[model samples]
Target chain A: MYGPSIDRLITALRVMPGIGAKSAQRIALQLLERNRDGAAELAASLIDAVDKVGNCSSCRTLCEGERCTICSDSRRSAQQLCIVETPADLFAIEQAGGYSGHYFVLMGHLSPIDGIGPEEIGLPILEAKLASGEVDELILATNLTVEGETTAHYISSRARAAGVAVSRIAHGVPLGGELEYIDSNTLSLAMQSRKVI
Target chain B: MYGPSIDRLITALRVMPGIGAKSAQRIALQLLERNRDGAAELAASLIDAVDKVGNCSSCRTLCEGERCTICSDSRRSAQQLCIVETPADLFAIEQAGGYSGHYFVLMGHLSPIDGIGPEEIGLPILEAKLASGEVDELILATNLTVEGETTAHYISSRARAAGVAVSRIAHGVPLGGELEYIDSNTLSLAMQSRKVI
Candidate 1:
């Protein structure tokens, strides 16, 4: 019902995660609420973000430059490396706090049937980062999903072949999660992962 | 963690309708992706829209100028007025097409808990518009929600003594909706709205 420019902007925004028709309408209304300048600014920012913050050539984390801040920081422990499937996963871990080591962003998980392989998802870059012999411990912090597990297994083999210690993050009931709402799989995992104090 | 200014932008965008934590992060990232220009443009547009678009003095529809375009245009049917809850609703009606009449935007519904009353929400202005003698009929197009119905009844009773013909939009099955999937209330409405051959 709006002009094509407005429609295109709505369509472009809808491509993002969780946005549906009603939500898209709200966004379009918001842009209109801001008027021409607001619409233009949002449009410009979206295009700019799409072009600018890409995978770092080194650790593969998102960066504005060729090298991410983690890769650029010389004081960060090169001997400790945390590996993740995507930049988003790295961001999630960073938000959880106390991660001082460098990171290797795989850019994706290994979904072989979907044609997403180790080579396709920055695994080559990860291998090179490991091959430098600077990393003593490579932490496999991928998601608990099947794809994430497969990615971890692949990376663990690669890292261990290079004689580096590999460790997986604990998988169990999430913090503050109630037992009543917990699924069978997670409940079992929690029982299996029980620690002796 | 980044600068508080960036954090503020993320918080500000998070309050936006339909934007989730991830989308808010994406919006914030885009702001950084475009640097100062993006922030400046966003801020400028936000301030401008807030400052510029206000209710038309005559009719309550949103306007960038002293009066809305529909109010200013002599060609529009002043005798027929459509009432809606928000400027966003006006856009929705406009997109539905074929209704070329003036509009009154209530901006908010009759929420007693919110302490909203007639004078506070531009009902006096609506009464004046209706009493101007140029208007022939008043269209009650407020939403079907409880608050919307209350507001519609309030507006209807106010204009009843003035001899204005008021009618609601057809209550029936929404276009493209399956009868089996629709609620009983909607199905009943569809039955009641049956037409002659």
Candidate 2:
């Protein structure tokens, strides 16, 4: 009832996914309880992150420097490229390890109803990257949703026309998954990926 | 991330309740995607809130100022004090427009296993406030949970010994609650508070 500034904080926080009025208030209170230095560090982080993050000119991954590390690294094999819908997916794959290949982040998946076109979400840039002849295999690491499949097929057809091999990442039942807990999409995919036992 | 700072931001965000590693990463990237000014504003609010909120000197409610509005308001009847376990509960009551009395916040309910004692959570201050003879009626608005009921009963006994009138908020089945979904305690309360049938 006192500070109107608190309302602004709550409103800003509520704009984020999953945070409701109660959570927004709690987060605001937590923020107000911390010391100035701690608060400043939080503010400084927001400024630093937003101001620093930029597109990696070579790849589409978020970068602070001229190019992303994976994009510029000499050790990474350019012939094998991983293409994901977002920089987040690229980061997820990187965290999982064992891949020393180059990456081309699409930054978004195809969605017609949302009016996000291929060029709008950086698919054409990926096409050019494939056309450079530096990549031999283009791995489609997009989500296993219907849109992702359609986008993968589109990319594959176009990339194949340019003489580059393309492959979609497996989206079958997860490792150690119980059949009862499996979703229809995953179950269908697992069935499609089945091998003779 | 191109910078270790991004990882640090994600780690810091993960400390907040309900935020997982993947969600934290998504939030971090979302902040990066936002304009620097917007992110800066959000960060500033987080910083500012943490810097301002302090416990009210009188009622011990968390506030930005010395005394909470409930304690400072002239129109509110301070002679009839309502005590609750949390600031959130007080806020909820206020939002519902049900009460127009002063409030004493207990921060949390009593829990012996958690090492929380009455003295440790400002019960002495509350006793002193009650003994001051300023409050004529002390309303116990603690939740119906085990610890809340125990704390409320303990506080009520002491208030009665001090010759101050003590009353608890009525309990019953919530409005719009389905009878099939209602629990035994709620059904019992509903029966006890039954009016014209």
lDDT values for all models? 0.73, 0.79
DockQ score of the complex predicted as candidate 2: 0.41
Model 2 TM-score (B-chain only)? 0.90
lDDT digits (tens) for residues A115-138 of candidate 1: 988787787877787788888999
Q: Which runs of model 2 end up more than 4 angstroms from their true locations?
A: A30-44, A177-181, A185-197, B1-3, B34-38, B112-115, B188-197
**Regions more than 4 Å wrong, model 1:** A34-52, A175-180, A190-197, B2-12, B20-23, B26-79, B87-134, B144-163, B167-197
User: Interface RMSD of candidate 1?
Assistant: 7.3
Interface Cα root-mean-square deviation for all models: 7.3, 2.7
Global Cα lDDT for candidate 2: 0.79
Candidate with the greatest TM-score versus the true structure? 2
Candidate 1 lDDT tens digits, B1-197: 43334344455555456676777876665445334454554444444455455557877665667787778888788889899887778888888889998888887788888888887668888888778777888998888998998998988888887778888887888899988899998898789889999
User: Native contacts recovered, in order, as a fraction for each?
Assistant: 0.03, 0.45
Report the C-alpha lDDT of model 2 over B1-197, residue by residue, as the tens digit. 54776877776666556678877778777667544555677787776666676789998877878987778889888898899887777888898996888998888878999987897567899899889999899999999999999999999999998899999998888889999999987898889888885
Query: In model 2, what is the error at residue A150, expressed in angstroms?
Result: 3.3
